[model samples]
Each structure stands twice: as C-alpha cells, then as structure tokens.
Target: MPCRTNEELQNLVEEAKREAPAGKVADYIPALEKANSSDLSAAIFYPDGTCYSAGDIKDQFTLQSISKVISLALALMDRGEEKVFSLVGQEPTGDPFNSIVKLESHSPNKPLNPMINAGALAVTHLIAGVDVTERLERLLCFIQDLTGNHSITYNKDIAESEFETAFLNRALCYFMKQHCVIDEDVEELMNLYTKQCAIEMNSLDLARMGCVLAMDGVDPLNGRQLIPFHIARICKTFMVTCGMYNASGEFAIKVGIPAKSGVSGGVMGAVPGRFGIGIYGPALDEKGNSIAGLKLLDIMSKKYSLSMF
Candidate 1:
C-alpha cells in the first residue's frame, strides 16, 4: 500500500538523498569502490504483480551479504532446521558481521547466526552440491525462480575480486572446519561463497525476489511455491533480527519491517502481507547499510504506515 504512485516514491527518494553526504561507498572490496556513492534507486513489488520504481532502477549491483538470506532459505530446504541450527546459532550478535570474536568466545564455537560471515560460510557449505559449479548453479536457479529473471548471474569480476581478498572469510571457514561445523575444502567453499555473494541484479529484480518472500515463498506471478512456508518464515525472522549487520535493532525500531541489507548498499524488505521493497544507494553508513536507502524506508514507513510493528 505504500507509494501508490511512482512520483510519490521519487519524492521520497529525493528527500532521502539528503543523507547521502553522511555516508561513504564500501571500499574494502576493491571492485565495490567504483560505485557512485550518490547513486540511489528503489522499487516496490506487490503481491498482485504491480510494481513501481524510481531513480536509477535499472542499474545493477552485486548481492553481497543480501545473498545470505537467499542462501539460508536454500540451506533450510536442503537441510532441515535441526541440522542447520546445529552448525549455526539463531541468536543475533552485537558485533560486526565479519567479527570472529564470538567464534572464539562461544562454547560451541559455532557462529552466532547465519547473517554473519562465519555462519553464512557454514550454511553455504550445506548447500547441496557435489562440486562448486553444481552448488552455484542450484543457488542461481533458486534466485532466478524467485525473481522470474533467468538472466540473473554472478559478476565474474566481482566474484574474483572478493575471492582474492577474502582473507577474513577464509579464516572463518578454517575456524569452522576446525570446530567440525564445516568439513569442506576451505578454498572450494570460498570459491562458491564468493560467487554466491557476487550474484547480480537490479532493483526491480531484487524487489521481485522480496515479493516472493513477502508472499511466503509463493511466486506472485503464478502462485508457484518456490520456498517452503516454514523456511520463508525462518528467513524473515532472521531478517528482523540480524539482517542489517549490526544496525538491525535500530532499523527495526525506525523502519519496523523484515529486511536484509548488503555491503553493496542494497536493502531488500518484505512487509509481511503488504509488499516488498528494494533499495540501492552506494553510500553506506558506518554500519554498512545504505544511508539514503535507510532514510527512504523510514520516510515511507512513516508516510504510509508501512511498518509491520
């Protein structure tokens, strides 16, 4: 029910652009450093198959951490809740997404949750595949089905860049392997994980994916169940709890929706039965969320009472 017109959404986007100066593009990944910090776009997809967008909605970006949500759903469908949770905890951590402090401090040595780097690696390990190619294909197929965009594919440049610079992620994989949480080759896992994170799409595709989640795993285009209902619920719960890196609690208080954000400055939001939102602004806050994108969501949440809370 939010942003009934594209003009209304554009107005919100312009207002939110004011916050871009307070943020910076993510430069840790050498490839991501090239993004235009001021670039912002958004799209909203409804269950009725209607969509409205504003700004540079056609521009594409890698999924980065947003892939965690999709991977988690696939992992759940591949491995049941019991097996998956045994390797990753359900609790949210206050630490940064890439921090390794919890793995050392926690008794079980399992990562606190799947949204973090360590836990996501573990979940990715569980993705059903005999080799990296097959696993990556499975994930890609799932994403394609979700968005109804079969052209969705990983950016090879970004994937190679991330694979080359993923020292911290490698460490997480090795540590999890040591604890018996993951038993795959660290390098192979890194290869698949990097490619998973590098999957690319524009705001419209991202919104369509979110709309699938909003509809509890049913494709709004044809009512086909792409994800199981219980699995979708679990993924949404994690989004509410740990989706925006360390800023999730604040995001919940202010935006009050089930959402996930990536370091690529992309946020995917599912407002329960209402609609799905996709936002992209390369300017990132200190917590790695899209600065203007967050503001845009806040404004929309307030103006249209879009918050599920």
Candidate 2:
C-alpha cells in the first residue's frame, strides 16, 4: 500500500466521519448521553516533530477512563513499581470492566490490573493526597505539566453525575477495602477517582499527553521528565493487555499498540517513541470503547505500520 500523504489522511478522516456508525453513547451518565454521536476528531504527533489533525481536533471532551493511564503513571512515580504491583495485578481479567466475579472467585480478590475500574480505584487509593482537594490539585498540576496547558480542569458536572451513579465503582472500592487492598477511606477514594476521570481535554491536548508516554515519560515539547521510564513501560504494558474493557484483546490484535479508551468517547494511543494518537467519538460499543475511534485507529495503524509489537 502506498503511504498516505497528510492531505490524503485528512480526507480519509473526513470520509470515516461520514460513514462511521453512531453507536451508543454511555447512558449511565446523563451528560454522556447528550454528547453528539457523530462527533469525530483525530490528531497525531509524529517523532519527527510533525503533527496532523482533522475533524473536531480542537473540540474538548471528558477524559473518562483515559484518565486511568495518567493516574496509574502518577501512582507509580509516587510509589515504586513493586509496591504498586502488590496492590494491583498486571494480568488482564478478560472480564467486563465492572465485573465483580473475579473479586470473589479468587483468593485475596485483588484487582487483575490497573486498567479496570477495580484496579484504577486501587491505584487512586495509593496516591498520597490526603483529601479530595489535595488529590485534585496534584492531578491538575500533573496534567498542566504534561500538556503545557494550564487551562485543563475537571468538568464538575461530569464529576457530580458520575458520583451519583457510581454504585458499582463504590462497591468495588469497598471490596478492595474489605480485602485490605486499599488503606484510604472509601468515599475519599471514590472522589479522587471520579474527579480524575472528569478531567476535561480535547484531542490535541490528549495527543500531547500521550506523546509523553510515547517518548518514555519525557515531555517531547519541553524535555521535562513527567514520568519515569520504568513507569511508562509498565503503564504501556497494561494498556496493551487490558485497556479496552473486555474488548482489549481484539484491539491489541487489530491495532497492535498500547492504547486506552474512555466512555466519554476518547481514545489515547502510545506508539513507544514513534508517535501518539488521540481520537474522540462519543458513540461506544457494548464494551464501552469508542466505535468510530477504534475504526480510525485500525485504518491509521495499518496504513502507517504504527503497531509497537
């Protein structure tokens, strides 16, 4: 296949937008249900210092589960890898994101990995922030540093809505507590986790953040060390193994890179020093991944040979 030029890539994106299926937007949260199903945006950051974008590249959307990658990296940096692993496993559960069967089926019931809601809540519990305000401050500061964008903040409305409907996550946190996996208060843990997921970002900002992980924790635009190399490696590994809820396996087989997707219609891909991709499409498959976003990634990965493995 011939390589696609920037102009051709832009055209391909437009064409995808036109034919993309309008899958279900997450309805558990009323706000997410209000998102435009046809909205699609994509941005790519290449290692050679070039950037390409099309569609609603500048449109802002909630990070949702995409924030998991960020907080997991932060927790790893704040604590050592071994310590973090003690609380969260690295294996993919092959279960639904919010499934509770594994917790009771296995001894100790530790979460299978940090990419799931259970694992993510465990990671958030490990953060040193003593309270919700402190945790949000640290998270915001890290986002600002990583993106070089000071305007990033949580969408309070989204946070409130998730908090209202977070029964499953709340139960997961309590289970972790019962199993002695987390030491923090359960409500505090929920607040920190929910607020992190509520962080607002557009495709371009997320692409830049993904670039940090792609560059092995170094912020390419400023050369600042946002996360340690080992931390970045572990986060990428988890993303590859367990990022897309139950659909993670298929995505790894098809896209062949470490990527994470959110219910808010955002997907972040890290190419391990080659490039980072950010795409948003509010409609999701049954497993809570962006349908159009996945299609776009599949096409681009095949065209550019962007898979890490």
Best by TM-score: 1
Clashing pairs in 2: none
lDDT leader: 1
lDDT of 1 by residue, 223-260 (tens): 89999999999999999999999999998999899999
Question: Relative to the true structure, how large is the alpha-carbon lDDT of every model?
Answer: 0.94, 0.84
**Candidate 2 has what TM-score?**
0.95
- Estimate the TM-score of every prediction: 0.99, 0.95
Model 1 error, position 146 (Å): 0.3
What lDDT does candidate 1 reach at residue 170? 95
lDDT of each residue in 147-259, candidate 2, tens digit only: 77898999989998998889999889888888899877788778878889999988888888888889999888767788988888888988898988899888888889989
Superposed by TM-score, candidate 1 places the C-alpha of residue 76 at a distance from the truth, in angstroms, of: 0.6
